[model samples]
Target: MIDLQQDDGLWTVTLNNPGKANALTGSMLEELLRIAEAAQEARALILTGAGRVFSAGADIEEARAGLTTSDLWERLSGTIADLPCLTVAALNGTLAGGANGMVLACDLRIAVPAAKIFYPVMKLGFLPQPSDPKRMAALIGPARTKLILMAGQKITAVEAYEFGLVDRVVDPENLLPTARDLVADRLVADPIVASGIARLCQ
Candidate 1:
C-alpha cells in the first residue's frame, strides 16, 4: 500500500501497510516505482512510513513468490536516485531487508530515535539490488556497509548517525517536521539551481 500526498511542489510518499510492517509486495513496489518516476516534477519528495517500522522489506509471501529478485526494486531506487529534486527518506522506524535500497538512494535520511537499520541479505540468501551496496557505501563507507550486509549487525539510530548512515536522529513526533525542514530551502530556491547542486554532489 502506498499513499502519495502532493502540495504545491512537495510530495510525500508513505508506506501504508503497517499491519505487515509495510512489507512490500510486487504490486506495491510497482506503485512506488510509478510514483517515483512521476515525482520528477516535485521540488522535494519525502519517503516515509505510516507506522513504527519503515519497512520489513519484501512481504514474506511475496518474497517466497520471487518478489525479492524482482527488477522493480532496482527501478524504484534508481528513479529516486536520479530524481532532479531533493529526496529524503523520513524513516519513521526500523529499516530492514530490501527496503534499504530506496532509503539508500535518497538525497538525505532522517530517522526517529527508535529506528534500527539492518540489511540481512546474506542470511536471506539473496544478493541486494545492484545499486544498494554502492549507494550504501557512499553514505556510510564500504566497511560499515559490510558490517550490515556481511556481518548482519543491526545498527541503532544513534549509531547510524555516527556512521553517517542517517543524517539526523530525532524524536518520533518531530520526524516529518524535521524532514520538511530539511527540504525547506530547496522548496523555495530556484529549481534549476537546487537540482544542479544535487546533481553535482552525485
Candidate 2:
C-alpha cells in the first residue's frame, strides 16, 4: 500500500508492504496514481519504500489474477509523469521490472549505496510498458538504457550514478533525510519557476 505524509511543503510517499518486497498490486498502483494526482499542493514529493527494499516491481501473483497490465501502466505512469510538484525517488534497495518506470518518471533520484537496479521484462516474455524505455532513455541516455533493457543487467548505486540514472548515492540510513533536505531546499525557491525549469529540462 501507499502512505502519504506531509511536513511543511514536502510530501513523502512511501510504499509499505515489505513482507512482499513491496511488490505493486493493481489496487496499490491505483492508490499510488490517486496520491500523485491529488498531491497538487505539495511543493515536492519524495518516494521511498519500507524495510530493506524499495520495490520488487509488479506483483506476479496479482498479475495472474486478471489485472489489465496495459491499463495499470497507463494510469500509474501518466500520474507520475504529470505530477504537479517535483518528484524524487529514494531507492533504498534493489529495484527491478516495472518499478523502473516509477523511478524514471521522477524529476530526480537518490539511491542508497547498496541499491541495485535491473530491468528484465524481456526475460519474462513481456516488453516494458510504453513509458519504460522512453523515460529511461531520457534520464540516462539511449546507449545505457539499451544496455539495461537488452542485457537485464543489475547495476549498483555507484554505477547507476555514473551512468546518469540517479542524481546521487548516499548511505542507506541517510536516504530519507537526504531526500527530505533536498526537497526542503527546493521549497525555498519559487514553485512556479522551479516547475518551469523542471518542465524545460524534461
Candidate 3:
C-alpha cells in the first residue's frame, strides 16, 4: 500500500504495508510511478514507510504467484531519476531486497539512525539487474557495490552513511523534518538550474 501527502509542494509518500514489512506490490509500484509522472510541479518528493520497516522489497507471496516486477522496477527508478524536482528517500526503517534499488534511485537518501539496508539477491539465487548494480556502484563505488551484491552484506544506517549510501542519518523523530529542511534549501536554487544540474548526474 502507498499513501501520499502533499503540502507546500512537498509530497511525502508513506509505504503502509507494515503487516508485511511494507513489501512492494505491483500496484504499489504503479502508484509510485504515477506520482513520479505527476510531480513536475512539485518542489520535492519524500518517500518513507508507515511502520517498522521501510520496505521488505518485492512481495514474496506475489512472486510465488507468478508476479514479475522487473520492468516496473526499472520504470519507477528511471522516472524518479528523471524527475525535475529533487527526490529524497526518507528511509525511516529497515529496507531490503528490491527496496535497495528504490532508494538508490533517489537524488538524496536520508535515514533514521536505526534503519538498515541490504540486498539479498545472492542468497535468493538471483542476480541483480544490470541497472541496479550500476546505480549502486555510482553511489558508493564499485568495490562496496560488489560487497553488497556479491557478499550480500547487510548495511546498518551508520555504515550506509559512512560509505555514501546515505547522505544523512538523523534521529527517528527528525527524519521527515530533516528531509523537509534539506528540500527547502534545495528549493532556493533556481528550478531550471537545479534541473540542469540533476540532468548532468543522469
Candidate 4:
C-alpha cells in the first residue's frame, strides 16, 4: 500500500504494509505510477516507507500468482524520470529487489544510516529492466554497477553513499527532515528553472 500527503507544494509518498516490508503489489505499483504521473502540482516529491523499510521490492506472492500483469519498471521509470519536479527518495530503511528501479529514477536520494541497498533480480529469475542498469550506472558508474549486479551484492548505507547511490546518509529519525530541507532548497529556485534542470539532467 501507499500513502500520499501533500503540504506546501511538497508531496510525500510513503510505502505502507510493513508486515511484508512494503513489498509492492501490482495495484500498489499502479497507484504509485499514477501518483508519479500526477505530481506536477508539487514543487518536490519524497518517496519513503512506513516502519523499517523503504521497500523489499515487488510482492513475491503476487509474482508467483502470475499477477504481475504490468511492466512496473517502464511505468515507474518513465513517470518518475519525466516528472516536472524534483524527486527524492528518503531511503528510510533497506531497499531490495525491483524497488531499486524506483530509487534509480529519483533525482536525489537520502538514506538512513542503517539502510541497505541491493538488487536481487537475477536471484528472482529476472533481469534488471533496461532503465535499471542505465540509471544505476549513471549514478554509481559502470564499474561499480557491474560489480553490484554481477556479484548480487548488498551494500550498506555507507557503501551506497560512497558509491554515489545515495547523496546523503542520516539517522532514520532525520531522514524526513533532511529530505524536506533538500526540497525546501530546491523550492527556492524558480519553478521553471527547477523543472528545466530536472528535465535536462534526467
Steric clashes per prediction: 0, 0, 0, 0
Please write out the lDDT profile of model 2 over residues 1-202, one tens digit for every residue. Answer: 7899988888899999999998988889888888888878888899999988899888888766745365776667778778768789999888877888878888889998878999887777777888889888887888888888988788889999999999999998889888987877678878888888877975
- 1-202 per-residue lDDT for model 4 (tens digits): 7899998889999999999999999889889998998897778999999999889877888878754435876788778987777899999899987888888988899998889988876666777777889999988899898777878889999999999999999988899999999989776779878867766764
Q: Best lDDT goes to which candidate? A: 1
Candidate 3 segments exceeding 4 Å error: 200-202
Each model's lDDT: 0.94, 0.84, 0.85, 0.86
Which tens-of-lDDT digit does each residue in 1-202 have in candidate 3?
7899998788888999999999988889889889888988787999889887899988998766644446788888888877788889999899988877768888899998889888888888776655789888988899998888888888999999999999999998999899998899666778888877877876
lDDT of 1 by residue, 155-197 (tens): 9999999999999999999999999999999899998798688
Residue 109, model 1: lDDT of 96
Report how far residue 23 has shifted in candidate 4, in Å: 0.4
Best by TM-score: 1
Give candidate 3's TM-score: 0.93
Worst 10 residues of 3 by lDDT: 62-71
RMSD of 2: 1.5
Instruction: Please give the RMSD of candidate 3 to the true structure.
Output: 1.6
After superposition, which runs of candidate 2 have C-alpha atoms over 4 Å from their true positions? 66-68
Task: Tell me model 2's lDDT, rounded to 2 decimals.
Answer: 0.84
Could you tell me the TM-score of candidate 1? Answer: 0.98
